[model samples]
Target: MPFVTVMAREAPVLVVVTWEKTVSASQTTTQKAIADEVNPGQWKVLKPRKGLQMIDFARLWQFRELLGMLALRDVKVRYKQTALGAAWAIIQPVTMMVVMSLFFGRFAKMNEQVGAVPYPIFLYAALLPWTFFASSVTASTNSMVVNSRMLTKIFFPRLIVPFAATGTPLVDYAMAFIVLLALMVWYSVSLSWQLLLLPALVALTIISAMGVGLILAAVTVRFRDFRYLVPFMIQVWFFITPVIYPNKMVPENWQWLIQLNPMCGIIEAFRASVLGTAINWSSLGMSTVVAVVGMAIGLLYFNQAQRKFADVI
Candidate 1:
């Protein structure tokens, strides 16, 4: 605890305590010799990290209490003044599904593509992940800028800003998941053991959103134009992802492109777990790969850019 505290503060904890003599003088001398041998210096110098090592996850872990505090702060502050409060989480996605069900379901007859599954349930399943992704990214992108005052005064991991942003929205995901449960009941869709994998799917969604969010948050500090860029990027992303339609709606020849969109596999798997549809193992595999690779790149870029955030912002 003391080590982590030192790392988090970038300095030692200077405290006054009464030293009780629990052991003899010989034992104290022996322990001091061993400690000296293990760590010759009483203190280690703190320096800005270098190269790919810039991301000190160990340090971040030591500061994890801060992450949770920030995440909780975000969750509370999000709907503080809003009339609907946390209901907004359920409302946003449910409204989108209703519109899609009416417009695309009846007008477009989109339900035929995915067989007997009702369009609302179908769209709702996909919308869950998409909404989580979109909201998390938006929260993360704006988090650093919105908390500029904290950024200048405090020195927690800059990545924590995005990390916390990504976490807070999962609360919305959980609230909206109740609607998914209701949809399952209406459609008579049965649950499966694969439902246990929901946490993994959630994790994949987090990684994908946090990765993109980290890159955007860090870059937006340098180039404010990215603020405009993110919304358009996600809007285009929405149409391209299989949110309103099933993956088979895309041509087989172009299916390769669907795998490139990390959300494709996750959304499909989510629907499958809920609706008892067939799981596309290949697509899920590719999505996992994309999420992992993308996360690495995002963290690398974020760490590389983080050093200048306090000055730039």
Candidate 2:
């Protein structure tokens, strides 16, 4: 028979056992039973997370390759079977610029509002960013539904879907931007140091678009009505933004109200960078604050809603 001893302590009780010679199968079973009674298996119960949680940026970084692949896939899918291929990117904004220049510039005499810069260059510069913003927002708004198969099949950050949607539009923006450079040269416009601010302005435009895109993407996933609403919203937004006309054309008193629109400041700053006009730092600062805050709120809502996406989507 095996000898068994027990040591009692204030903190915990310890069981000690000694075996003499070869132990029998029944004795081994008894030892295991003792061990099971003393130290039982542990289990972790998982419950749904409540409320907003911090974004797992480390996990996102771990899946950086997946994000890049998704973005590239979007770019490829955009121009895949299109007749115009990538040229459609250059054509859309350029066509809009021509029509706007004819109507708003020549007919309304808005060219004077732009001062030394020709109306074509001015309109195209604004259109470049506007077109990119509109395309990105629309694509992102539809990203969840468009990629529903992946959402149902696999697991990844839902944010990556909308974030990847921006990639296709960014490629479009680059194509259109080359045309803007050509237009600048054609109009005898000289590039200045202010052009260095282009990257910052582009970043601001992206932040604003993503802020709006995130909200719309989340809402659109549950309520499909936004599918029809987003285009009309983008159209209305284009008019409110200083895309067709210069920001200076607005009355001084009402200019502050115009500045309230995030895209207003971005478009104006973009024009200033490319056209060498005076940059409105005050308006830009307000826009920066709004963009950052909007992004935070959108992220919060999206994160909270993402838990339900696998089911809802």
lDDT tens readout by residue for model 1, 1-313: 1332223223212211101121233466677877774322222335664444445555576588988898898888889998889999899888888888999888888878878787888899999989999989988998889889999998777888888887668999999999999988888888888788789999999998877888999988988898899999999999889989888889999999878989999999988887876788899999999999999999989878888899999
TM-scores across all candidates?
A: 0.85, 0.84
Q: Across residues 19-77, which tens digit of lDDT does each residue of candidate 2 receive?
A: 11112334565677777743222222234565446565544655778878988998888
Q: What are the clashing pairs of model 2? A: none
Which 10-residue span in candidate 2 carries the lowest summed lDDT?
Answer: 10-19
Model 2 TM-score relative to the real fold? 0.84
Candidate lDDT values, in order: 0.82, 0.82
Ten contiguous residues with the weakest lDDT in model 1 = 14-23
Error of 2 at 130 (Å): 0.8
Provide C-alpha RMSD values for all models, in order.
7.2, 11.1
lDDT of 1 at 48: 60
Cand. 1 Cα-lDDT: 0.82
